[model samples]
Target: MDEIVKQSLVKWPNVPSCTGWLLLDRRGNWRMRDEAAQASGAAGVAIRHEALLGFINRNYEVDERGQWFFQNGPQRVYVELGYTPWVVRLSVDVDSALALHDQGGGGFEPAAVFVDEDGGILFADRAQPARIAVLHDHDLEIFSDHATLADHDGSLSGEFHWNAQLALPLQGIRRDDVAARFGFVASPAALA
Candidate 1:
């Protein structure tokens, strides 16, 4: 949390939370959902301002109920998730080693990999498995190059080669069951 945001919260502790106004899309884009977009059930406009994006990322947090929100100084602006809470992309570090980074530029080590029925790849945080992130679609080809899939007794199994030294087993997951299995709310607006 930002120090300025904390001070604002203490100064105005009764600000009501706003929902259905902001969204985090599957491709890691932060969208602004205005009344027109909300009424028509659209994805809204993607926010491209760099500084504003940074501020939102810095204030992003989750409540005990697994509802993700951004503290905009005083008011809590609840985020409507298009998929998983985190949208991750694969990148090569200075050592030319594979690394995982979220949309907000925060890095996390992947402990487990899951392939959904829709062919989407997701990574579970090594330090906190409950933190699931969907791999950015553009990185699918790179991910496929480092992954191996096999069939065993009519079921699918695989392994993601992190490098010459390590491989993590990949599991199968159903798209619809992701929220319940991983403990996150995809649509906080519906709950609200």
Candidate 2:
């Protein structure tokens, strides 16, 4: 595994249960096979093991290079190239910083929270609607709104690309939790 993937796994053990490989092209673009992208929803996307604790609402945009920017209310979080595969995971951590990890189970920590199914959808194909995950941390009174899947055909290096948006409310986490640092991780698919 690449250092990126190893570091990511060590930092956040709950890798998103992706069905196929998610790739970042050399030009810093992110891509997944159409089938894989289609299968992976916001739920399947990776998240911060500790993020289920706060309130978060954010948006995202991806350039041709696959570089990503997350806008949460007035704040903007940037994910550099080569770290696209860990976007979902980072969303969770960002939420935790806001103190949204409230719900538990489903392979997440007990303090971790999730939104109702009606709030979002996971898109398996371009023709499908995007999936969303809402998480909350009751003790911290934090909530997060996240979208994990999207379709991007534009290639930065003749490869596919993908991006997403995540939002969080600073009020959700403790007032002291505002300066939480964010990071990324990428895990390679296991061989069959």
Candidate 3:
């Protein structure tokens, strides 16, 4: 959390939280959901300012209820997730490593990785502070080179093919079960 945001909490401690106004899209973009956008059921407007994006990223946090939010000064603007809490990207510095760049900030340590029926790769740490996350689509190809990937039934193409000889104890699970199984809410109950 940023010092300024921390100070705001102390200065105006009772500012009610704001929800349905901010969203972290699957592609790792911060979106602002306005009244019109919400009514129209759109993905809302994209927030393109670098400074504000950095500020939100710096102050992003999750409450005890597992609701991720951006502490915009004093107001807790809960974010609606497009995938999991964090979006893992392929590290620019490394050739075969993944980087977590989402509400939880940088770096990821996925104990297990699996592909959803829709081809989205899911990572679950299952530790004390477990993270049920999705690897960014753009970097999926690079990840295929890892010897532990699971692509049985020969459904995958190119480097993502199933190689029982190099499998890594992979398992299958549903995306909707992520919150309940991992104890986090993707979309929390509306605030009164």
Number of clashes recorded per candidate: 0, 40, 0
Write candidate 3's Cα lDDT for 77-192 as tens digits.
99888877777775444443334454336666556666566777776664578877777788776666553453568433222222223234455666777777777767753532
Candidate 2, superposed: residue stretches over 4 Å from native: 1-58, 63-66, 83-192
Every candidate's CA RMSD = 1.8, 18.8, 4.1
- How far does residue 139 in candidate 3 sit from its true spot (Å)? 1.2
* Candidate that beats the other on lDDT, 2 or 3, i.e. the better one: 3
TM-score of structure candidate 3 = 0.82
State the displacement of the C-alpha of residue 171, model 2, in Å, after optimal TM-score superposition.
47
Q: Show where candidate 3 strays beyond 4 Å.
A: 92-105, 147-168, 189-192
Q: After superposition, how far is residue 186 of candidate 2 from its true place, in Å?
A: 12
Candidate 1 vs candidate 3: which has greater TM-score?
1
lDDT tens string, model 2, 1-192? 234444655666654333233343322223334555535521123334343212211133332333343332333233322322221222234433321111222122122222212321111111122212222222211122322232334211111112222221111222122112111222223211
Q: What residue pairs are clashing in model 3?
A: none
